[model samples]
Target: MSIDFLKKYFFGDVQSSSDVSSVAFQQSALRILLALTLCIFLVSEVHFLFTAGDYSFLAINSVYLAALIGLLYLSRRYEKATAILFLFTLVTASILLLTLSNEFHAEKYALISLYSLPLITRLLFTFKASIVAMVANLYPFYLITNNSWMGSAEFLDSANLLTSADALAGASIAPSFYFQMLTFVTLNIGLPLAVSRIIQTLESHAIKMKDLNQKLNSHYAMYEEFFENTGTPSLLCDQRGKVLKANQLCRHLLTGGIKKSLAHSNITDWLTPAGENSRFAWQSDMAECTLKSDSQTHINIRRASLTEHGHLVIHLENTTELKAIQQELESTQETNSRLAHFDVLTRLPNHRHFCQQVNQRLAEHDKHVTGAMFIIRISQFKLLNKQYGKDNANKVILSFAKTLTHKLSDQAVVGRLRGVKFSCFIPLSQTYLIQKNLSELIKSILPKQITVEGNKLNMEYQVGIAYYHTDGKNAEALLERCEMALEYSNSVERFSFYNNNLENKLIEEHTLGLSLSSAIKNKHITIWLQPQVNASGDICSFEALARWQHNGQYIPPPQFISIAENLGLLPLLAENLVRALVETLTDWQKEHIHTPIAFNLAGQELMNDGFFAFLMALVTDKPWLKDRLELEITETSPVMTHPLVHKRLRSLSQYGYSIAIDDFGTGQASLGQLVDIPANILKIDRRFVFPLPHDQRHVDIVKSTIQLAKSLDMKVIAEGIETKEQATLLIAMGCNTLQGYYYGKPSPMTDWTSHSNAKAKTLRMVY
Candidate 1:
């Protein structure tokens, strides 16, 4: 091994200054002490063999040398155990060597070696272990001093003989021996203890310095890494604005590339000041500066002190792209603000914006400044859309908006309130004049023969006006009053003003709606059946009709039905009516009556899938009820055009419930709708049937309707047969079923049962 390797192996690896008192240090110190002891033993053995020709001292040294070698070998494997074992060996070997030396007349050398034991143990081990080793080593010396073993001849003779003749010739050896022994004890034990304490204090200071140096190195490494790897451009400069050190990013940003050293270069030479005072400052604490480059690029430079000696750190950030992005963000915000206040299609104030403006004006206006709000509703707009399509309809609406904007630009604020509806706020004094002007503008801008997409269309509108503070105080209230006035206006009436009478009627309608909703829930609405008879005058089926009586006065069907529909309570009313019909049918079933009863369904009821599903669930277990049930729907119901409603109707038909189209001729159902609808029976409207046999036009229409129904495989039943003549005419016209006052008016189930029994008895008598 190399000298360095050997040193490391025998002692320890080079320890940091901070680790001088660590376990490795202690072990290295112990190993060195043991090595020195081995060298001393070798020197003593050679000296004794050459000068005194005594092999005993050499043998003692040999035994100790072997133990030291073993301790050294063990030190590499188990340092702590080896250290303790070495201390014990030192104490034990000292006692053995002292005894052997006394036997060989070498008491002086033995006493010297024994005195070193406590010092070696204390230096290498704990104070307690050293004390125990010192006591153990003193046992031999105690025996020699007390003459405990001198009674033996061998010990007495060895003790009497001295290594030097001068000591042996002395008259009394005790005093001289005592002086030499005391001197040896002081030098060996006291010197080692004092020296060891000094070494320990020095090691403590070394450790503190090593720790401080390591901490400094760590901090420096962190700063170096941050300087080189930080994404931002950085430079370390002196007070003169000269670059002392720069990171890679700083080089690339300032000089394009690191082709040459940037050391001691004046930083201000490459940058122009953004302000009028374009001079570089020599003194700096912390400041932000804007600098422009040769390529017209803008840079933000932050200069801050890095050291007490006026060294500064400069950070560079490019602001060109950031400024562009900020500009784009501001532009986007502006566009969004505009969109929030104006309609995207017409670029006019929208409903929310219009309401805000009106509210602001109302808050600012005095009581003397009376203003009026006008809501212009485009009539037949839905029909126009249906005919010309949405694209052209939008074009027409846009044209109307443009006309309003142009005509009322100076006099009022105009806005598109909602679909096909526009609003204008103008002075109440000029209301009449504005209305007249608008009428003329409407006539001129929206002509009767206006052509769009090669199709001529007639445009019409209705205008409703509500005066501010008189009709309402806020925008919402004014708008609601305008809508109410518009609703009350007729097709012929182009404009109307808000009035108190309309509000009273609305209150009455709302009151009626509440009453109807309660009546439906309480099952006060009763079912009345109108019988439909065959040509033989035999009652075949009864059509179910809903009748409501409140406080002994019957409410008309049209009024209550309209009220129910508007209140969104039509489904509840329909369900209660169906329940009554089913109960009546169940009674008939119990009496063995197989007659099917038809119930009317409104358009809204037909659209409710839940209603049909409820009916199916109610009669799911009663196959007889399903067989005897019939559903009658008006032909004009908008639900008939819906594919989902049509599917549900077909499903009901498949479930064995008869489906009928009532008042067929009164509705505007297309031929295709009539064909596609799943109906087993078609009831000709009473309008045509009431004038039957008298007007040939009515007669011809009924006959043609019956022929159409027959061709479609549907049974034709003529309704409103109030006379035998009408029934006879319908029977002759291929209509086998008739329903009207001629047979029986709609009556309660009990009354209908009595009339049906009476009719049955009369028919029996005739047969």
Candidate 2:
């Protein structure tokens, strides 16, 4: 077994012992004494039985040796009990040997064994046990020496005790022997106990020192790692500002300085005057300072005391990058502020800035003081952009702004309000002179033309003026009035002034637009059908036109139609008209009349896929109505070029519905453009059809249009056939259909129903 296991088995868990070292020392002493006792007894037994032929003394020595061996075995299980037993055994052996020496007259051997008992007992047991064993062993010596005890004892008389010459000699020397024995007892017990205590104290002190040394080593390692690996530059300094130690980061920071190593260097040499003064207090919890080295490098220093002995720990953190970032952020903020107030392209104040300036000026105005604002808009600017591209177009606008600003310097404040529109604010006193000057400036600039990429481009402008205190009292009101005047100005007139009539007209138009949604919802919009006739004068179909009547007065179609388009209500209006016409056709079907009805599709309605889907869904269950339905499209519709419009028209035509191009001649569409449109009929404009046979120009135009329709394999329908002569001329010109007053004026479905029935009957009779 291992030594630790053996110690635990003999000592019964040394940690549980009050003092482990003391217990270990006592155990070692007990084993050594026990072995010595056994050896001494064995030698004595051999001498007595073999050399002297003494059986009694030999048997006693054998018993003593066996007891010592038993003690050795018992010590493993019960150390304290075995220790007491060993001490008792030592005392018993001494007493027995002494008694035997008296019985056998071998006093010299007995005295020698008894003399070592005190030293062995004191080393093995505690003080009290050692003293008690010594006293008990002394009683045997007293009994051997005292004659009275021998006489009183009956066993002593029967034992035949003899007094040899050696015994007499021992008795005569007993006084001096007792003195020496007493001195030996005192020295062995007291000296061994004192030495054991001293040894225990030394062991305890050594253990504590070892533990303290381990703790110090662990702390030192942690401190070393922290100082060397930390990113912040650090240093240790004394009370006099002398540097004691510096970490790796601190050494790197001071590499290029006058003193390469910070150790033993005065800290004041590196710090500014303010920093050195701040450190004079030394007791401050924390202080910040700046360090400018001899190399001109800047360092931010943070210092604090590490110990009460006036030791300071300094940390350095570089802030150069942080300062640079702050400067960059400030620059970006300035740029953003500039962008917010001024236009980046033209370098003029933006619309918002202009509005703010105008409001500020108006707030500073006194009563009776007046100012004028002009909104100058470029004419055909979109066309110019398309011709020269956006870059050259912007150049022209920039040139115009620069020239205008130079001409009106100090007389007005000008700003670009929006694309192709510039706004100017000036005192009313200078309005006439500024206006004349602007007119002259534009005239001179137009003739010279704006040169962009070596190309000369001509531009035109129109101006609208609104005077404050007369047109408006605020910036928004003035700008709105100026826009109305600009829209109402004639093309020939380059400028116009805001008047009360234009404002009143705008209010009326706005009011009409607001009521249009309710009119459509209430079904006040009705369809008026104009009949179309073939060459034989038989009615073929009727064209459905939208009519509105409100409060017993009929509103003109042109006025309300434009209003509806501007208000983005064209889809709703077209759907209402289509529903009315479908209902009228349904009624005609119930009356056994199956005439196709054509309805106009607005530009916005054609582009709206949702409305087209709604129309298709309405006729899904009434598939037969597709054959009697015709959709007419204006050639000038902006949505005509849209892909969705082309897709819907083709889808409708594939579903057996006829598509017709209305007012074909007046629109800008050419024959090539019409070729892609899925149209079955081309309607000749009313202007060409109205003058009929008498106006040869009109006659030739209609004839040529009819010929064009024939070439495209499309039927030509002549509109505005007011007279029989007009109808006759259209038919002779090879027009397939005639639609106008010659057939029947546009009337409600009820009036057209009766007229259509009479015409059908008359045509049947003629046939």
Q: Which candidate's TM-score is highest? A: 1
The alpha-carbon lDDT assigned to residue 208 of candidate 1 equals 79
lDDT of 2 by residue, 1-767 (tens): 69887566544464564444556767777766666777877787777876866677667778777888888887666778787787667657655655554553444445545555655666666657556655655665565555533443434444444334354344565775587457555554555567557665767786786677678888999998888888788888876778888887777666643447676787666654345556562234444444545433445666754777768887766555665777798979977887898787788888888888888887777767777887888887898899889987898889878877876647467888889899888766554445566455445533246677887776667878788878888777888899998987767987877899988999988888778878877767888878888999888888888888876888898888888888888888888778777776776666566778888886689777777887787668678788678889887767677777878888887877788998887765557548667898898888877676888887777778788889879988888888888777777778888888778888877665475555434443222
lDDT of each: 0.74, 0.73
Off by over 4 Å in 2: 1-318, 329-338, 356-370, 430-448, 473-477, 487-496, 500-530, 535-538, 547-556, 567-569, 572-593, 612-625, 642-644, 689-696, 721-734, 741-767
**Candidates in order: C-alpha RMSD to true structure:** 8.0, 10.8
Cα-lDDT of candidate 1: 0.74
lDDT digits (tens) for residues 1-767 of candidate 1:
69988788766666533355546666776788778777877787778777866676577678887888888888777878888777667656655765554454445555666667666666666555546655665566676666554455555456554555454345667885597557555745565567567656766777877888799999999998999898898898886778888888878777756376778687776666555444554243333344434454566777754678778888887776887788898979978888899887777788899889888877787866777787888888998889878988888887767766776636467788778888878765654445565445444533444457776676778878787888888887888898888887778787787888888888888787888888988888888878888889887888888888977899998889878887877788899888777776676666566678888887677677678788777668787887777888877766667787788888888888888888887676557668777888998888888776889998888888899989989998888888889888888888979889989888886674565445424433222
Q: How many clashes (backbone atoms < 3 Å, residues ≥3 apart in a chain or on different chains) does model 2 have?
A: 0
Q: 413 in model 2: Cα distance from truth in Å?
A: 1.8
